[model samples]
Target: MKGKDKCKALKEIRAKIAEENDIEYVVSECKHKGDCKGTCPKCEAELIYLEKELEKRRSLGKRVCVTGLAVGMAATVAGCTPASVIDPIVEFFGGGIGTEDLAGAAQPPEPVMGEVEPPIETLDGEVEYVPDSENSSEEDCSGEDCSEENGSEENGSEDPNGGSEDGKGDNDIPDLAGEALPPEEF
Candidate 1:
């Protein structure tokens, strides 16, 4: 298409994208009129923005399509119905195929009488929670060990005098000698 035609198409695409994405774009009137080359800075910037947004949406659409295709193929391979594969994708995309759309759809099979369900098992066969007498685990801290110890590292306590062994905790300020101190700035 010609430059003018392409620009027009892009504007239309941008308008559609804006509408779908709940965006608002106001078009300004061309001041150049007959002398307009259509490649003005404003038009070029808009063109770039629209192209990028379109590309982003196109990539997302492609990803969704690919995902849906893979899921459909996997469902088919797993002997699942098309509706089983398609319904979830439709729901996910905020769309739905109504009962009317699924005319002559296969009904799910009813459970047979006297059907004994198999017990669920883990990789190690049956999962049981048996406690070992040797390695007894405690859920909570209790007894003398549970109580906070004096001068413990966790409590940040260094000495019984509330300071380091040589005296002065982190919050203590040191006395500055007159000559050692820097002169006050005016």
Candidate 2:
């Protein structure tokens, strides 16, 4: 594309990016109670400042990219081949020069292969097991009574009503207050 068209496209893309960034920032700030309709005045003011800064950065990036493209194109058209354009393409893509191209030159000596030595052992001996001094196993409790040494039984077998000491069942079902309701005829 022509330089002017490229610049226009770049500027449009930059403007879109800036708009998206500002929208995301606004959404995040509003979520944190920054927008005027949401909560504090100070946060709203800060949001406005951040939006302006984003706009300024976007404008600058577009201007710089366009200017660089224009300068590059002009230089190329004037027969000034830039090292930036040529060097990378040549180094990465160009095939190596053939041996036929260097036909009468003295060739470098072939690389010599050294003998492979066996790998040395690094460890002196087998691993030894070290028992931990503070290894304490947890005790298994019987169903009858598993209370700790200082206090009451863990189960509620001592309660006469077959309920807990607090009068609550394990399933937490409340006791019926009076006689059960009569069965429905259906």
Candidate 3:
């Protein structure tokens, strides 16, 4: 993307974000906060002037910053110390009223989930599942002396070759039973 195109795209996104965040609503909320003992004319005038300035910027196709919105919504009135500590926001509605918490006011939208094709493909045009070697332990056969955790023989007198209690293998041919299995048994 070219620089000009990217800038235009960002400006478009900024307009959308500004509209969705609704700076006017936040300003109204701030003005309604009960910190002002009465209708302070100074604070009201300052807020109204800031709102006009923000509106002018918007009309001129400029991107509105969340931080600026917070500051614009600030309510500074006389008889309130330096008056910079005052704000209309419920989150930081005290002497610390500033653009510090503006970032939290605007949250990004959540992602959407949808079905899609699998990423894998083979020469035969099918998705074949090949188990990973490191994680595969089902085929790990040590021998008859292995622990019963791997389903091997216990400490019983039965045949280590995996024969039944009646001294017969699973095939039931009744051959040489009660004997140790071959070293490389499957």
The best candidate by lDDT is 1
In the range 12-103, model 3's lDDT, one tens digit per residue, is 44344335433321212222321222223333343333344334333333343434423333234435345455453743344222223244
- In candidate 1, residue 113 scores what lDDT? 42
- The per-model lDDT (C-alpha) reads 0.35, 0.31, 0.32
Worst 10 residues of 2 by lDDT: 134-143
Clashing pairs in 2: none
Per residue, candidate 2 scores C-alpha lDDT tens digits across 1-186 of 222233344334434433533322222212321111222333323333333443333332311111222233222323554767567757556523312213463222221235342232221222222213212211212122323321223321122124346734233222324777889998
Q: Candidate 1 versus the native: TM-score?
A: 0.23
* TM-score against truth, every candidate: 0.23, 0.15, 0.18
Between prediction 1 and prediction 2, which has the larger TM-score? 1
Estimate the overall C-alpha local distance difference test score of candidate 1: 0.35
Write out the backbone clash pairs for model 1: none
lDDT of 1 by residue, 78-175 (tens): 34447855777656675422222145542222223465433322121222222242123222222334233212344332222343456332322223
Tell me the deviation in Å of residue 41 in model 3.
Answer: 0.8
Which residues of candidate 3, in runs, are more than 4 Å off? 1-39, 67-186
- The segments of candidate 1 whose C-alpha lies over 4 angstroms from its true place after superposition are 1-9, 35-37, 51-186
Model 2 lDDT at residue 76: 30
RMSD of each predicted structure: 34.4, 35.1, 34.8
